[model samples]
Target: MGTSWSARIVDAPPDSAMAIEAVLNRVIAQMSNWEADSAISRFNAAPVGKWMALPADMMTVLRAGLYMARLSGGAFDPAVGRLVARWGFGPDGLTGLSAAPNHPAPWTAIEVEGDRARRTADVTLDFSGIAKGFAVDAVAMALHDLGATHFLVEIGGELRGQGVKPDLQPWWVDVEAPPGLFLPTLRIALCGLSVATSGDYRNFREVDGTRLSHSIDPKTGAPIANDVASVTVLHESAMLADAWATAIMILGQDRGMALATRQGIAACLMQRTASGGQEYMTPALAAMLE
Candidate 1:
């Protein structure tokens, strides 16, 4: 919610323009807290004894989240919601400058039944990582359905683009470094693709000169501390890019790079050095950039 978003549509039909706006409104209805009766809230409110029927959109994200959990070895888990809340990232809220509260295992201990899901362990579901990207994709699809062939849809720093801009150039994106700095940009001819980034510098709290990031490792129920300053991912779906970026950040440099390579995900990692400089992309990611 602390991020900014913008969209530009070129050579779009009038109907398509209206449809794009409608789709964004729907996303707000489903995602904004003011619209508390949305599907996500229902799933969160469902009692332990009963399973909730999730909307198709929610289910889509849940399935992808589970896959990402497996792929990242639980480094990225949406079920870390309870832990997030304990640290003030959740609705109940934070402990200020103090350290985040220790949380129990995530909803990974939960059993999912079709549209219904349950946690064997006590945990809350947090879709913060994937939701924005999912929304971006959804918005892009809405535009596409309306016969808009060229556009970039972005929501809270997550984005998906299709076709060529009016200038006939590929959609170019820049991955920002820590403290909100951007270096060499990555350009992509967004025929139909999405990109997302998650970094510690985005939304965080400072405690005694130490900045505590919102991204938590479900494995340790703690914030990850590594040399990596940021991670950006590119994929067919913004949701995948979003979740994978978080996973790679938690996984850190070597292991994260290996997983990205094995999974065939194009990624870039920026690491901070002791000399106050930054290290650029990993070999695999560099190749993708090329």
Candidate 2:
């Protein structure tokens, strides 16, 4: 949670800003890996095999994380926190060394029973991929409860829009692209929709001259190595969009586009090439464009 958030709403109540802030704070307290006392940190610190009771919000995020892990066949694992830390992407900071996971696909070992959850292995839970998107959806719901029908919510780069603007226009936003890429700009009307993008250009580290992306491949127990520059996903639920974007990015263009087509996911994948960059749009996204 090292970024900013904003909300653009029509007829916002005086107290709506405070309510939005409260919702964002609540999500941070539950999932921020930077916070030592966050619920996710507590779960990561908890002894393996011990069931820990979690707050409803934390439980919800964890459930969704595990679901995406399974659905993506470990490509979008929430239990890759140890790998994230070793790669200098987490609170552990950068150390010039690498390590492997004790278990392959550690997410499969996570078990959630009602409001309680536990891990069978020494896996660290990180919600970095999906938490921000969920926060956007949460803020949107808060706005609705505040009697605002038309609003747009954004956290970091993920965004969601509901209803329309004062001018009766849908909230239109241009999806992000990697710099220096001469790709066609893609825009979408975020009416009851959410969009999330994962890219190697954003958060990265240089190790002895080689740039390493923040995206850790759960299968490899290391940073992903591919030409995939970024992947964008559009969904009704920002949480799903965020997770899917990360998953598809890890899968690369060929496999990722195939997966997107099979699952009927609206996705756009961009890859770095010798000249510049290449783009691929899945049938789901192409249908939307048409």
Candidate 3:
């Protein structure tokens, strides 16, 4: 919600843009951590051990986040919201944080029942990793409801594509190599798939003379230190792709690639190298390119 969004739909009504923006605005109201009045912010600011009613969409994303936290063995935790705030990535906007606390809360602190949720401990939830992908899917659904048969929805680089262009060509997205690394723009076809990328090259800081990623590993409650430049995942659901990309980014090169292979997911990971950069792809991702 802090970033921009764009959508392109074939033979769309002129008001399609407005419709997409309205949908995005709804998503922002529901889940934006930057917005003080957002549902997530309200939940985060709520007192501990209080059950709060959440919208269906918010509940869905929360469930997905919890699933990812378990699937990644705490590597991708929603309970790290306080860690994000302490590290100056939260709404407070205080930069140059000297230190960070360990995961402020555990996922187990959360209890969800139907449309109501509560924290057993001093837990906070953040959806920074998965909200945009969910918003993209929301836009896709909105467009379809508006009678769009072919479209591409993107928010902050996360993308979802359905059908094809009027010319019958699939939506093409250009994947750039990480900054300070020289490589050609890799064009990826986005047809019947959703794609998301988690990169360490952007949104980072220099702590103790070492460049560190802004993405905190929930297991450590610290900025990630790894050779991974970026990990891109392609899935049928953009929200799942978004969560998987963050998980793989936190897992680093070897383990991430191993999980990608074991799970049989489409993932392309690039790691930084002294010479330049090296690419790693799971069998599914390689097959997609082929």
Candidate 4:
């Protein structure tokens, strides 16, 4: 929610921009940790073991986050908000701390029932990894409801496309690569699909000359220290794509690719190697290329 969003629509209603902004605002109200009154912030401040009623939109994203956490075996955790804050990525800024108490599968402590969710432990919810993607899908749906069909919606870098451009050409986007990396540009059409990528280059902090990525490993309660430069995933749902990208990035190159292949996820991963940047595409992505 800290970044900007844009939409390229064919025959979009003049008022469509306002509608899109309204949808994004709702997501920010419910999910942005930067806002002190956001649903996520309230839930984080809620008394431990007390069930807190949350808006449907927050519930939706929470469910998706928990699902990804389970599917990735804790590689993608929504309960790492405190960890994020400790690293200066959140509202509290950096505390100059190198690490925190590691919790084993902290996401498991959260329980959801109906429109209510509660945490058994002192866990904080952070949707930084997935909320933007959900906002993209939300805006896209809002556009569709406004009778706009041909459009491409993007929040930050995650994107979703539907129908086609006025020229009847598919919405094609070049996959992002880290700067200074020499790799053949790869492009994909996001017709009725969404793509999200998690990379070490997005956000970080330099500690004693070491660049620490914003992506914290739930398993370690610290920033991810891996060779993985980035991992991109494509899904029909932007929310899922966003979560999967984070999950795969946390899993690193080998295990991430293996799990992605096993789950039949279209993913392309790049890692910084001793020689240089190396790219790997899963079978699902290879099939897409073919």
Candidate 5:
């Protein structure tokens, strides 16, 4: 939550507004790496045999991430931390390699024990998939507790909306496709719903003529090279939506859509064409667009 976050509530009381701001501030403090004592920073520093009891916010995110990994057949894995770190996405700098380490995936080697998690493999846990969405949900709950009935919450690109504006309409959101592509905007009415988007556009580096994305495939321990460029998931919980979006992206277009359909999750995938054009959602995902 060190990144930007916004909320809109209609006709909120002054005290409620202040409480909402306080909640956002707390989220930023807990999630930001700039703060030395942030939960994420502490988790990163935690060593083996040291059982760290995660806060409720971080616990919710880890649980959601694990659930998504199971749901996606380990396609969406938080155990790619070592690979992420080697790529210079973590607190450490890059390993000067064009690709990730050629090791087996780490998710299968990690273990979760109640509020404490451990990794037997030489990997760390990167919660980037679910942290933003969890923060959004947490802040939204805080606002709701402060007596704000209708509002929208967003952390980074993940979003959650509840009830409606005073005018009696659900919060509307526009889903954008990746760059250098043309596609119709997805208009969603968020009524007690959460949505999350995961894409390769913003987080990628180029080595030679090939482009490598930050999101890794746990099975291969490598960056995913697929036709799909982005995936958006809509679900009851923001954390689940966020993790699922990343998992779907890792699973690639065909298998990703199949998994989504099997799980009855609404998903949208934006694909890049060889001609530099864009293809819209898959049939299963397009059905959810309506």
Candidate 6:
């Protein structure tokens, strides 16, 4: 996770902050693309057709990533590692050329069995879409283990919260809307759910005078050419929300809204309109506002 993280706990012990920091850093060591020795990096560096043993948690995330790829119909994929590197959003950002590869890999080529996974093809794996959310979850678990019943953990703006403050109020969070969206902010009462927001306003590059989003449409092996301003997802698991948010954003406004409705997903999608922006929300998310 190449972002800032924060943990706020009610009645947290003196050493709880340091403990939570250590826990988050440990997660980074396991999944960080920037770390050459990270478990995920090792898996990526492994030759094609070679099985790499992974930790149980990493395997769980790999399974989840595959599930999301299927659910989104390839709109969101972890196998876009090569595209990520080419678009200058990977471990070596900015210096890399921003051009799509001729033979980029797809997520379907990966094989997973128990705590081991291998690529049947020459596909590289990138976990940036979901790793931060996993780190947030880990921090929340660490806080719970430290006897913190009321806590909120956020990594790169994806967050999870449990329990109410001592004053009996829920942990309130302000979800940021992209610059062009009509609504600049949406507030939520966090009790036992995670929130993840994905947008093109941030984490993108202006490639050759064309603003290219870091989010690549695996189907085309190129940056998605959609007018979606931003999308936010709420779920019990931040990792799920994180991956889904990215997928739904790539699907564009109409398709994303339809999928969110058909699946009963609590999602908010904003589309870039001529004047400013328009938005949509699933029924569950509407209820949250009320």
Clashes of each: 2, 0, 0, 0, 0, 0
Off by over 4 Å in 1: 1-4, 15-18, 28-35, 95-105, 180-189, 280-284
What does candidate 2's lDDT look like per residue over 119-162, in tens digits?
Answer: 89888898999999899989988888889998999999999999
Please provide, for model 6 over 232-259, each residue's C-alpha lDDT reduced to its tens digit, 9 standing for 90 to 100.
9999999999998998988888787788
Better of 4 and 6 by lDDT: 4
Shift of residue 7 alpha carbon in model 4, Å: 0.3
Off by over 4 Å in 6: 95-105
Instruction: List model 1 lDDT by residue over 57-155, tens digit each.
Output: 777787888888888888888777766765667655675434433444465665788776765655666788888888888878877777788888888
Instruction: Write candidate 4's Cα lDDT for 1-290 as tens digits.
Output: 77889999999877998999899889989998989998999999999899999999899999999999888999999998878887889877876775584667889889999999999998799999999999999999999999998999999999999999988899999986787567777899989999999998878878889989999898888888888888889999999999999999999988888999999999999888777789999999999988
TM-score for each model:
0.88, 0.97, 0.94, 0.98, 0.88, 0.94
lDDT of 5 by residue, 1-290 (tens): 43677788776656765776676666555555545688756765676546677766666666777777777888887767777766666655566656664546566655668877665545566777777887778778887777788889887889999999888978999997788768877889898989999998888888887888888887776678986788998888898888888988998888988888877788888888877656545455567566
Measured by TM-score, how close is model 2 to the native structure?
0.97
Candidate 2's C-alpha runs over 4 A off are none
lDDT for 243 in candidate 3 is: 90
Residue 205, candidate 5: C-alpha displacement in angstroms: 1.7
Give the local distance difference test score of model 5: 0.76
| TM-score of candidate 5 versus the correct structure, residues matched by position | 0.88
CA displacement after TM-score superposition, residue 146 of candidate 3 (Å)? 1.0
TM-score of 3: 0.94
Candidate 1 residue-wise lDDT at 142: 78
Candidate 6, number of clashes: 0
Better of 1 and 2 by TM-score: 2
TM-score, prediction 1: 0.88
Better of 3 and 5 by TM-score: 3
